[model samples]
Target: MIQTRVFPGWRVVAGAFVCMLTGYAVAYSFAAFFGPLEAEFGAQRGETSLVFSIAAFLYFLLGLPAGLVGDRVGPRPVVTGGLLIVALGLVIAAHASTLWQVYLGYSLGVGLGVGFSYVPSVTAVQHWFVRRRGTASGLAVAGIGVGTLIGAPLANALIARIGWRDTYLVLAALTVLGAGVAGLLIRRGPHFYGLEPDGEAAAAGKASPSSSGFTLAQAVRTGPFWAVYTAALLMSFGLFTPFVHLVPYVRDIGLGSGFGVLLITLLGVGSTVGRFLFASITPWLGRRLSFALMLIGAGVMLVVWSLSTSATALVFFALLFGAFYGGFVAIAPSLAADYFGGRALGAVIGALYSGVAFGALLGSPAAGYAYDFFGSYAGAILAGALLCFIAFTIMVLAPEPARWLTRRARSP
Candidate 1:
């Protein structure tokens, strides 16, 4: 009797999933901590929101280097080091006596930590699959939705029981244990194991030691690259505003904090579902088209969110917005892979996300400041909606890469 072993690619996907779940859970849990941190620090909404903005900005900006390094050195050491940094940041945040301390500890630490780990982990997944790339990518990033689902409420409950300071410590421990272990499971690519992508047996004539794909320099010069980058930048301006503000927004509308937490939870549930649901349909809808539709849908949802005052309306907004948001997150990498190939995908993806870093840096804080001035989030929400629409237009109008067009012209 012959025993057939499971493909190692699935293991890679599993590890990437856990890493994304743990890292993003820690990142998104800031919503649960928002009100408490504001009260504890005696800070304004803008100040409080800036912490999250800074962290988001740093992480996305650092992604370029992290991806570059991961491509060179592999993901394990980079991811493990990043997770440890997140733990340290959390520890410092737990001990914070001043708001500046929170910035120093949480903003820099968690920002840098997630930055180092996220791109590398996601990039590693791209190297492992071809046939099931969309599904695999969705599954790996679905950890983010699951993490958001678990992290926010868990933080809220823990803070209720143990206070915010101790809650940070608890999160720190969880990041170390969970993400640390997951990072170890990442391998560079299938070639390292004498296998091809999707676990196809390597044929003598077809075997390639390294992934075949565009280099960072070549990818950057393509029209599709800039289109994707521009769209990402615009979408991000609205994309993260809810994550940082939805809890507060619910409260501002006279809902209880618990209700706010519930909204965040619903967002997570929707996000998880969207990742699986959208990725499954990409083969038919096409990755680019699916992403464009989701972008427009997210924008429309923001308009609904701006007008929503009732709990029921807000619930609808959160679920649909989350689904669109999560779908795009899962699809973007696969789309990039479709255009650019996997050779230097980490760097290509990283470079594209650098646009997001700027948008995130501006978006959340701008919304917070708008609330401070206007005494409502209405203007910010509407502006976010407009940005999303513009992003959708840009994405839909963009042409395919010349290389892909040429390849198709030559194909039978």
Candidate 2:
């Protein structure tokens, strides 16, 4: 159980928000430094993109172990350690002269920190709010958007004024304060605080045999796991492709940099709203149904994106499509927790996100190659639409976590 008992429930929520904002927010802002890194390091687009991919891969790759550690040792050390590593990575990146060094600092150091902080935050917060699980998780992950909102522009401004190297130093110090300090505060089970998880001020929490959820081994073997994995893979496949191309795509189509940046920001806002709002609405809609519907909606938007050109159309595309994609990020993990237990929640979500890392590996380069091969993004967008449809079909077939709970409840 979480140890500190001085604060109320909302305080926990606020802490979760701050931890997330610090952990994810600072790392995300690095994109604005991309041009500087490329100019200074003489890296190609593909190579620079891999820095993101590698960091992402490690971020998810370390998830399971972090989850196991969180379960056994409690989330506090994991989170605190993660924040420090992330902070160090930024500092290291600031001084690095080579592209490989940048990869080391960002992907290995900072990426590892993300696992320590991100998964534990989600799982721990899950312990705090059950009936309101959707909203709680929504709020927690919403920091990604909030972070993106604040981080993106700040990073851009910092890079322009202070140099990317100095910007990293400043951001690192901030992360140390925000994520590092907040993570040190995380407690394991809510019971230690004299309040049950989802009890009293929280309200209506239950633990069934089904609540044992899936062990990591069981999660690997289940059809439901694969179904969820496929859905996530497809969502991520479609998600990152556009991000990789957005700025260039707009410029290629003759939209000004100002407009291009606005469209990208719109996407972030759309996604943030989608994460919070769609997640809040998930219980009424049901998880699988909600995910499936979002998949279809995102697929439709992909088609729209392929045809869009004008500034207004691009902004609208980013707004709507971003919402669908962001909404998926918000809800997917809680869905995992509902199906699997909170015991290995970090690892399971980590593994799932690892698959998303693979999707990013596929999405960005594949989109680039496709454009080169076919001489158009048209083929690539069409391909993503087909994949999203397939993911939708899989979600339709997958059983709900509620059914799993009921089955366990009825058993001896």
Candidate 3:
């Protein structure tokens, strides 16, 4: 049992940090496996991209139920079970001999596992910190960026040292060791341990009002929810194109071989800085404007990228664009919590991210098809920028729900 004397919510944050780090690390590492899988499967780029889309699909699509379950039961069971599934998936992928088996074991298994763990970890953080939701969420989701940083280089190193097959096996062990222990430490909220959301200090003084926001059905009924969803869909559609294709895109641009995989590293570094930077300032800037600004910044970067000629230009574009993109990801949950209130935060966030999942599913393969058809990434890059601009427009025009404003007015 966690002690009541400590801020248990921070413990939840710590646990979530590890779970996200492990889960996303494994997912992003798919890029490292990309070349190997292409050779082994003898599949087209689009087809190979489908494997990731399928995994991402199940991961996001399942958020509705997973969030609902976490809201009702607890996050621990959901997360622990998901980590176990991740381990199983990695093990299956490690030994598979066919593409279908890879789809089944690696894509389906890891996707579902990540979905289960992700919603719960993110939602759990909101429950723990009402005053600092933005900061806490930034710290939590920063794991994805950090994992990308670690996972990309680590996966490449592992693949080089052993082999892709054995690499999966090693990942399986780490997933079980790191994520499993972290998942065990996570509890839903401070209330679970007989402490308040921000621990005894805030509880003894004036506790922030729990949000009286929309339930799932009512939330879906609103225009703002759909607007946010549309923006997310568009943003994700554009953003994932770079993430999935940047490595190959680098190689395609005639950059030296040494720099192909290093793009992920550069993007990771930029995102980490962006995540922390944005989270720290969001409280002052407000969620809506901050989000809109990030989107716009990212859009401009993409536009510049379409014209980049040299490797130096691409690297600079990648770092700046990745920073803006990372900041956007960190703020998403806070935006949801801000709009909907903290009542159904888990479920609302999960539903919102469903858009991200769908976007990735549609966007990545579409980008690949563009490459196959046009023989260049220029078309796709421009399309992504267009999507980001559209999302920024919606963010500027969209109105916040009355419930959220009322809660803010009441806050001390």
* Model 1 regions lying over 4 Å from their true place: 1-4, 207-210, 401-412
After superposition, the stretches of candidate 3 with alpha carbons farther than 4 Å from their true spots are: 1-5, 201-211, 400-404, 407-412
| Higher-lDDT candidate of 1 and 3 | 1
TM of each candidate vs. truth: 0.96, 0.89, 0.93
Worst 10 residues of 2 by lDDT: 202-211
Residue 5 of model 3 has an lDDT of 65
Give the lowest summed-lDDT range of ten residues in model 1. 400-409
Q: Tell me the lDDT of candidate 1.
A: 0.89
Q: How much is 24 displaced in model 1, in angstroms?
A: 0.9
For residues 164-188, could you state the per-residue lDDT of candidate 2 as single tens digits? 8899899899988986557655666
- The model with the greatest lDDT is 1
TM-score between candidate 1 and the true structure? 0.96
Q: Compared with the true structure, what per-residue lDDT tens digits does model 1 show for residues 1-412?
A: 1124988888878888888888888889999989999999899999999888999999999999998999999988888888889889999999999999999989998899989998988888889888889989999999999998998999999999999999999999999997667876888888877788888877777745347768999889878999899999999999999999999998888998899999999999999999999888887878888888888999999999999999999999999999998899899988888888888888998999999999999999999999999899989989989999999999788765444658745999
Error of 3 at 182 (Å): 1.7
The residue-by-residue lDDT of candidate 3 on 310-381, one tens digit each, is 888888987888789789988888788778876777788889889888888888898888888889888888
In model 2, the clashing pairs are 1-189, 2-187, 2-188
